[model samples]
Target: MQLDHVTLVTHDLEGTCRFFRDIVGLDDGPRPLFRVDGHWLYANGRPVIHLVDATGPARLSGGSSALVAPRIDHVAFRVAPGVEWRALVERLAAHRVPYQLTEVPASAEVQLFVALAPGVVVEFVTSLPVGAAA
Candidate 1:
């Protein structure tokens, strides 16, 4: 099955949206009416990131504590090489977001990691053409 989307419960909803929009190149788009406040971030016309407002009085069912940070290591997105990859890296740098870059061993793929929030990190991966520099 293909991945649908990722949900983030955050007290800093606007800040998180800014990070996704300005840094990750996602657009803040339409979201259906729900009890709580939030935003849906879309990429390529698909809502890939869902943000939930943790500071709101409304609580989700199942008694899940939004204050407790998720244990996810990182969310990864495969990006196009060359211009797309370079532009993403440039945006991260321009925004002063700290990121680590590394290449896969014996492969043409490179990965960049950025800590998006407490206990939340995002990874961008791209495969470079043979003999092309990252």
Candidate 2:
């Protein structure tokens, strides 16, 4: 089976929305009528990131103000070839978000690594289409 989505808890829903939408170029997708303030970010017409507000309508999980980060080091999204990256880089610069482009060893593919906030690292692995991912 393939990957479905990655869920992240955020204290600032709007900020996280902007981080993924404005900075990462993902569009907002429809979310279920769950009793929580959250958003679904879609890429390749699929919901990829689910953002749950730490202080939303209901405490579906932990309700502390402490930033809840992903347990794993990072969540990676495979990017399609020919994706315009200059604008993304510029957006990162505009927001003062630090990032680096790292080439995957033994392959021509490159990975763009960026942290939206402390403990919120997201990686964009380039040169792979949705269905072509292994």
Ten consecutive residues with minimal summed lDDT in candidate 1?
64-73
> Model 2, 1-134: lDDT tens per residue?
99999888778889999999988899998999888789999998999899988763332356665544336568887665664655666788898988877777667677889876666789977664433422
lDDT at position 98, candidate 2: 83
Candidate 1: stretches off by over 4 Å? 56-70, 130-132
Q: In model 1, what lDDT does residue 107 have?
A: 91
Global local distance difference test of model 2: 0.78
Q: In candidate 2, how many Å is residue 108 off?
A: 1.2
RMSD of 1: 3.1
Query: Estimated TM-score per prediction?
Result: 0.85, 0.72
Q: Give the TM-score (vs. native) of candidate 1.
A: 0.85
Q: For each candidate in the order shown, give its overall lDDT on alpha carbons.
A: 0.88, 0.78
